[model samples]
Target: MENKIINFGAGPAKLPEEVLKEVQKNLIDYEGTGLSVMEMSHRSAGYFKINEDAMNDLRELVGVPSNYKILFMQGGGTGMFSAVCLNLMGRTGTADYLVTGSWSAKAAKEATQYGSVNLILPKVQKYTSVPRQSTWSLDPNASYVYYCDNETVDGVEFDFVPETKDVPLVCDMSSNFLSRPIDVSKFGVIFAGAQKNVGTAGITVVIVREDLLGKPMKITPSILDFTITEKNNSIYNTPPTFIVHVMSLVFKWIKRNGGLQGMYNNSLVKSKLIYDIIDKSNGFYACPVDKNVRSRMNVPFRIGCASGHEDLETEFLKLCESKHLIQLKGHRSVGGIRASLYNAMTIAETQILADLMESFFGNKKR
Candidate 1:
């Protein structure tokens, strides 16, 4: 524990210490296979079983029904933006997007190049809270309704799933994936990149309802097609073997630590410690996100009451680094501080950061 540093980066965030130690212990020889997972053939039984376990454990954790096929694809969430449009847009030629924050906005923009994308709610200058569903224009006949459950940038989160009735719902859960329990049956497709809460950054986990497979646009690449990945058991080509092994390990760790409900409870505690400090800080520490819609995974706040505190913000980040806290800087689009509380960041470590924020300034409102 000497010279320990906590990583609060949004992606490729800190992983569970136990998982890391396991990997370190087996790096040279995985499962007595006589070769590293990195060097093993993707077709080999060892790597294939690792891939299968990760998918099965994740499906159990998130409650994905038997009707959905889980595929481990490359290119993260950005690639899925194009794949979504390619696969589903042709079904109805138009999709509805609820652009709550940066990622959703980017997804909607990418979708425009493929088919008709209707922004149900007008874009806003400030991406603080999710707009009321009543204000949205619901296109009942659209192919699907897309939304980011938790926006990593902008710090806004949807507390409830949007009801599309008969229309399928697509979600990008890249940031908050596995942080809480979800009813997978409600969604047509649910995708998440592994780096945040699962493992490393080479792969993305996509769960697609079996009924929605095989109908991609003609331009869709075979690699990006869900049917192809599903048919091949998510190994159409050589997958990221090492990352998949790590993912499988992380999945077991989550299971051992009491599963999804356990993760959600820990999230509440870690996030509350930070929010409590901000709330008590008066105006010295300011959170740009709405109180109700604030994200548990990513908390973004400014240091000088949201106006003209650029110098103070920099100083604060420097001070945090001194305390062995890194990646607390907020996104450039919204300048401030961001504390990412992924699964691996322990509750005690979160307290250390919270205590630092508490001592940063007086509780009196500026």
Candidate 2:
């Protein structure tokens, strides 16, 4: 197989090459069924096994407790913004949201339509670091406390999970899901769009505590109701069959590669390779995020001077592409460069990027 350009996009990011190879091998005829897994019926036994194995593998990987119901839903994390509000906000008419970055802010905005949203932390000009938990004015009467585990666009991650006391802690782990080990028992609802570290787009993995189900608002759609979806085992209607199959393969790959701990270890090494380069480049490479809250999944940095360096940033991106490194461009909201070192991104690939950055800065200095 020819070498492919490294992918560093935030979502729909790179899949393990071995998993892709397995999919290619089975794309034409899956397990001698003479039909692609995508072409197979969702109700078929083969597909049932696939879905079951995926869920079981995920549970094993994350050490999810027996009380949590893992539901593979259709909508992305954006959809969960409302579903979480509708389903879980009935306990209290208000939900407290920690606005750490773009996704969490959007989620808080979406929740306002279903219930009142209390911003636990004041809005900031840039999401550089998570606010101290002590400073947050969390509502004890709120239904759930929502926060993003990792801010994809801003590249800020929580060094410690927020403690909400009696309030259920709801987390959107979209960008950094499966990149590290998490205490599943602490969260009431943990949802992630599969496009990131899991598989592809079209499926969302939702792990909700059993107590959180059966409590949607009166106007909640049947599809968005966790009770109904969990009762049917995430197949009340036609599911994202192909995406689930791919995700099953991803689960297997994660297990083969040593589960969550292994992924976490690799994440540290890969992220450090780039962060080390940025820190050692004097002032050439600048990371806006606080050192303590820097994300291991996404590293967003700027080239050249901090201000009025668009030309240098553009030239840096072009040079990266020429070296077969792609998707290094940052999100439009915070324009610069973002290197998403997902689970599939190898140390070798990260080294190439670090070398590229060093060379680019060396050349610019000359």
All candidates' lDDT scores? Answer: 0.91, 0.91
**For model 1, how does the per-residue alpha-carbon lDDT over 1-366 read when each residue is reduced to its tens digit?**
335898999988999999999999899998898899999999888887887788888888878889989999998999999998888889889999999999999999999999899999886998999888887878998999999999999899998899899999999999998999999989999999999999999999999999899899999999889899999998899998999999999999999998989999999999999999888876788898898899999999988776528888888899889988999998888878899999999999999899888777743233
Q: Please provide, for model 2 over 1-366, each residue's C-alpha lDDT reduced to its tens digit, 9 standing for 90 to 100.
A: 125688888888999999999999999999899989988888889889888999999999999999999999987999999899989999989999999899999999999998889998887888898879878788899999999999999999999988988899999999899988899999999999999899999999999999888889999999989999999988899998889999999999998998889999999999999999889988889999999999999999988865427889999889888877899899998999999988899988888889889888899889
Q: Judge candidate 1 at residue 255 and give its lDDT.
A: 94
Residue pairs with colliding backbones in model 2 are none
RMSD of 2: 1.1
lDDT of 1: 0.91
What local lDDT does model 2 show for residue 215?
A: 84
Q: After superposition, how far is residue 216 of candidate 1 from its true place, in Å?
A: 0.5
